[model samples]
Target: MNYFKKLLLILIVLGAKLPLIAQVKLPALVGDNMVLQQNSKVNLWGWASPNEKINIQLGWQTAPVVITANPDGTWKTAVDTPKGNEKAYDITIDASNKIILHNVLIGEVWICSGQSNMYFPVGKEEGTWKTGVVNYEEEIKNANFPNIRIFTVLTKASQKPLDDVTGSWKECSPASVKSFSAVGYFFGRNLYQKLNVPIGLIASSWGGTKAEAWTSEKVLEENTDFLPILENDAKNEKLYQEKLEAYYSDLKKERIANNNDLSKSQLKKPKKEDNKTSYVLYNAMLNPLVNYTMKGVIWYQGESNAEQAYLYRSLFPAMVKNWRNDWNQGDFPFYFVQIAPHKGQNPDIREAQLISSKSIANSGMVVTTDVGDANNIHPIDKQTVGYRLSLLARAKTYNEPNLVFSGPIYNNMKIKKNRAQLFFDYAESGLVKNGDVLKEFEIAGEDKVFYPADAKIEGKTVVVSSEKVKSPVAVRFAWKAIPEPNLFNKEKLPASPFRTDDW
Candidate 1:
């Protein structure tokens, strides 16, 4: 061969190699050492030179599946995930690149979402946060859900939808379970014990994140009822960056002035003009895996939006519908942990959650007013939060018999003379008080000046009467901050926080 001809061939080879190196990229969620969902169809995707071939293999199945990259340099493949133990998987693309995912498990999968309460783990505990009927250590050791794996979605907000998230899946073992959402773990453990199946939990959450952040901007814009909140988001995003910086600066100064450490799970001063709050996280985190199939979702949020109680009545339902539509799974059993008791206010936000829970279709809420801490926003007793969520799964999702799902929910009321007669839907085992008289019942006439009312459990109903109001028009139970509410069913679940009057 002539020298000129050989030199030209080498140049062509080198040019081809450069494109191979620069044109290939993998989605963060599909990187090395990841776990795929089992007993169902799991998604695997990434980017490469347009029109390149991609192949994926799993322990549960034989033979690799081939796919072609799109014009936009994206590729996707769904594997019929198998139920199995911790195993290794190799996914190869175009016979040149390969990703090895280790320690993958297959079983029932769930999504645990919310603010910090659902994000709180057993490791991040503070003594100030306490709860009732929680046995943390026992639940942890007894959590032999080896087949149960968990993948946590990081807190990232975006202006538009994303294709891949920045995290991978991990098994639900002692080592990995410590950082897993405590409530999610307990909920899965309960299901594992009851159903004896593998469980995968996807916890996508952020501390102090409002409900609007997890929802898509398009969905928010579509809902005219939620337009006000979405409008505020546009305004805040425009004015937020600088205000956020200033707010952090003040927060740092306050901590330093008080000789306190801001690193102790504390947030800084509120930004004056942060309008970009609504759709940021939706694009970054949730949009990446909008179609991840799951048996159900366990939500534990609402502290950040507690003040906007009325607004949440619309925002919460819109977000749920948006998610169900995005998943395209026909309302696959939406279950969530009711906002537990948090900081000064006891049951108002809980009531808001109850209102949203009833509003959504094919959905149920787990009441936690009985499991709240007045001083701490992040309650440490996540065991109950998870177990109760799983209980809803037991009766509603898995069709298990003899499991009580919820407390007394106000179905209807009859006002006669000075007293109101209340009837409940799920009054399983009837009504009973554990200790003091039902503490949160209040009565008011047309004036709506609430006065303490006497309450007595009559069969499945709690008759509330007030001497101050001769003709009672309304009644509220467990509706105040740090309210001494005490109405429960014989099954031990707390009665949902409710008010008879619109106000």
Candidate 2:
């Protein structure tokens, strides 16, 4: 070929490749069908060539935001979002190459996170063990809310923090909602129906994971009680390496013994690292999402931590604080579900959750004593759970007055002769037993020995007395692995289990 012809070809190739390298790049979340927090300055970040000038044009506004990339090729800027509306907007980014994000919405965005129950989908699969939520068929068919959107972070674990996650915003439809988080969907649906605004739910969860896996290492290190989590994780990593080495060695020997027939060998490979390892999920899943603005969070977990339920009293609150600090959003609402009645779940976990709800400010808890099943770990009635969470958000976050969002919480106990009078906080209209008589009440004397007590409701308080204990010093109600407490407030919300004594 001629020299002039070869030079032209090289120039053409370089022109095409240059734009590919220098063009702006966005995170998975800052893409099409994304929802930015309404009435707030939402952060938008991306990478580009060093010192490159970028122009961002919001469809709702006329003035374009102009910024320059840093030396490290990272750039972030805040843009104001209007109030929630049905009008669709577009975001245009102009730099080395133009990129347009279409169909953006401004509304309430919530982060839905936790373990398996939070990860449960709305529709059942054919081969999997997931039986789906109650009335799954009808629910899935009616899930056609165009204003509600969901972004599900794929399961990932890392030893170090990540820059971005793997997910995309999808419009809520029968096809899209089936695989999305059921609790997240229902919660968003309720919010959309009540507030009549665009609702965005980001589901970042994994089944059978622990709170330590979702908590940051800095927060865990601050407390001496959480030091064991880091120590145990180091030990587990070492053990995994040792097991992997042995497995490879055994597999090599098996392959040789089978005349080099790889198919005949039955040696199984060792797993790399557990998803339940400390801070792995936070590094991979949650860290990548810190830049995105959200209204609040909804969590459902604690089954795995039941063994060390005592530690969860501190661990759960620390985890919430870590996220709040990282997000830099001042004390945003964080609502969670109390671990329900199950044969394998300890009652201490529920108590720890109840304590956390009181300890943490702007936090709410949904009690599921009435909806729990003794044999099933994952409850089927997610609609009620989601609706109750939405009620808390409506009453507390959205400032809807005169709404009963919580069940009755035990306040203080007073001893009157041979009986103990139990007062509660949310029994404004008085308490009522669902059955003929109230059960699960027990009275303890000075010896700390508790016996079944006869309980009767008077006004907003319940009086308990036991013939076995003449002098009642304390009282405990629904203190068991699986309890069927019939107590409820006039709002039909069940009362959380409580004990006057620490023991």
Candidate 3:
């Protein structure tokens, strides 16, 4: 072939590839069958050719929104979404190439995140440990909510923030919901039924992962208490590298000794630090979806952080603040499930969650005292968990007036002779004990030695007295691990475990 002809053919091939490289692309959350946050200015972003003019057309709106791509080929703009309805919409983007998203709904979009409980699936999958929620077959058979959409972010861990994630939105069905987060699916299902609007749920979770793994590095660096997390990460990484080197060295020696006749099953490679490593889950799983608009977040984690329960008092709220700040949404509702009763999870972890729910603005906690199993860490009663979370969103977020969503929260205690009269915040309609008598109530004198007390509902307060605890200085309810407290308000929500004294 002639030199001139070869040069011309190369130019033609390069020109064809240029068009493909410069084409517009979008994040996984902004694709087909997705739901946008309702009645708000929702952000839409993507990448195109540098300085290219991008036009976005919403199905409900007449005028097209125009934006120019930045030098790095990134473009972002906000468009107002109307109130949620049953109608499905379409979104079109025009840049170097055209892209269209179909079956887009405007509604309440929620980010469902946490550790294993939130990662629990609706139905069991083969060759996996997720044994499914309670009544796996029936739940899967009944799962047919088309208006509810779910997006499960594939599990990933990154050392730095990522721009995109690997997953796609799917309408809820028996097939799709099988692998979806059971808590997330039930939560969205409740919202769809209550609000009568399309519900979007984004499930970004990792099982057996710590809260620090889902928090940003910058947020952890700001607090000295969280410094230990970063320090431990450094040490684990170093140890992992050493172990990986030793494994390879041993493998090479064994291979030479056997004349490369080794079976793969005979050896195990050094496992890398997984989702437990600090800040990695947030960088890969949560960071990619921050720009996408949502109503709030629902979390069901904390089992892994039980060992450092005191530090979690600070870490939990800081992580909430970190997310709110990153989303630039002012104090959006952040509802979470308190750790259920189990031998591994101590009472102090639940106390830390209680403190965080009170400290963080626009936050709520769902007490699982009534639903927890002492032997089971992943409690099977996710329906109660999801339903309680929806109640908070209904009353607080959706402004369902006069609806009681929370269980009795401890307010104060007064001493009347040898009896301690306990006051509560959510017991306006009065308290009710499910059992013959209130269980888990204890009173302590100056020595702080708590003894079981006889507790009775006295209108909106509980009066507890123990002959052993004369002149009581403090009172506690459900203060031990695996406590089955019978205390509740009229609404049937279980009272959160609480103590009057720090000690």
Highest lDDT against the true fold, candidate: 2
Ranking by lDDT: 2, 3, 1
Candidate 2: tens digits of C-alpha lDDT, residues 1-503: 99999999999998888844577999999999988999999999999999899999999999999999998899999899999999889999999999999999999999999998899899997655369899998999999988898999999999899999999999999999998999999999999999998999999999899999999888888899999888988898899999989998988887788887888666688876568899889999999999999999999999999998999999999999999999998899999999889999877899999999999999999999999999999888999899999999999999988999988999998998998999999999889999999999999998999999999999999999988999999899899999999999999999999889987
Q: Could you give candidate 3's per-residue lDDT for residues 299-357 as a string of tens digits?
A: 99999999999999999999998999999988989999999999877889999999998
Higher-scoring candidate on lDDT, 1 or 3? 3
- Show model 1 residue runs off by greater than 4 Å: 1-39, 81-94, 125-144, 237-276, 343-348
Q: What range of 10 consecutive residues in model 3 has the weakest lDDT sum?
A: 124-133
Candidate 1 Cα deviation (angstroms), residue 461: 1.1
Inter-residue clash pairs, candidate 2: none
Write candidate 1's Cα lDDT for 115-218 as tens digits. Answer: 77777775534542333225556555555555676778877766677777766666666667766778887887788777766667778887778889888888
Model-by-model lDDT, in order?
Answer: 0.74, 0.93, 0.92
For each of the candidates, give the backbone clash count.
14, 0, 0
TM-score of each: 0.84, 0.95, 0.95
RMSD of each: 5.9, 2.4, 2.1
